[model samples]
Target: MMSEEKSALTQTERTFGRRQIQAGHALMMLISRAIPHPIGEVWAAVTDPDRLEQYVGRPEGDLRRGGTYELPDGTRGDILRCDPPRMLTLSVQRPGGHSAELELHLTAEDSRTRIDLKYASVRKGFVLIDAASGEWAAGPGWEFFLDSLSDFLNGENPEEPLGIIGWRTFEGEQLGLYQARNAEWEKVKADWDHEHEATPGPS
Candidate 1:
């Protein structure tokens, strides 16, 4: 499964070199960026609920593994893994909604910090049409939040939470490429699925 699922995608298909790949029926979204700040400083800004509320959303919890947190929109999660200033994992879900996995990893790079963000749907089966839709969701959404986080790190105004509409325009411009990629991804996914003799998972 692992061997055949390696993404045959180019950097051009990625956002800031972020790779989106098919894992069974799952789509693993990966985004990474280097921020100009110490790892601890970067970690603190991200982990602190108050600091986060300034940019993204409200979160309240002890923030340790086994801890539970409430998001501003009432989405909640339990910390599945937590290694402060290094890595954190959570099983997230909304009220009466399907669950998802969110993970954050931090590393030091000279005087700056590198962060990788991943969001994976737990049970929802994924395909290219959905992935194109996801690009419109996770890509611009994270870009907006990261931009806000950057501003907060520099003691600047943490901008408002930008929505998915901006990427709607992006989707319009990339419609042709997205459609082609969707078709290619669908074929690759179908081939991989048949090769593995696996049942399709739930969406």
Candidate 2:
């Protein structure tokens, strides 16, 4: 059962929802993970700028509902909703007129906390299939962040805090972990695709 337990530790769920937008079909990606920490602690780690700097990049600006924030990487966004230690929603404005909505929901699971992240965006001139299949970058990227968050919570320092972009910077055991996680994600994606293909779509 050791293998099963290991799989449980890295378990993640991804779903895509389609909706019509002015440009075309909009896709929403939802990813969830369970962290072995209290809800309050997880909330602080995700929302507080100081703690966020440990795993995610440090963001600057008024971090509250109706305020604006800018990441170190030059990405800017507005804080659409902030429910404090529970939910946060943002409208991310990227370059080239690209925009996206991100939502984070935290639920308490006994002594652990469950984090649900939703990312929705509309491709200006792309079809649903085009946007859906290229999810390798987004999916594995978020998984890395969540994994880094878990490491930080457990008092472990991550060698690469920037996730997939800095893949080549990691070495030895850290590099091995990143490669292993990528392989795991590939298996998860394959299984998800197979099951969905056999199932019926919404009527």
Cα lDDT tens digits, model 1, 1-203, are: 33311221232133211222232234555557778899998988878877877766768876678889987666788888889889988876755575667778899998898888776664444333454444334443443456577878998853453321333444453444445445554555566556667677999
Give candidates' CA RMSD values in order.
9.0, 5.4
lDDT (Cα) of model 2: 0.70
What are the TM-scores, per candidate, against the unseen true structure? 0.62, 0.72
C-alpha lDDT values of all predictions = 0.61, 0.70
Clashing pairs in 2: none
The residue-level lDDT of candidate 1 at 50 comes to 72
Winning model by TM-score: 2
Residue 97 lDDT in model 1?
A: 70
Write candidate 2's Cα lDDT for 33-151 as tens digits: 88889999988888888887777778899888889998776668899888978899888775546677778899999999999987777853221213344332455556667878888
Task: For candidate 1, give the lDDT of residue 38.
Answer: 95
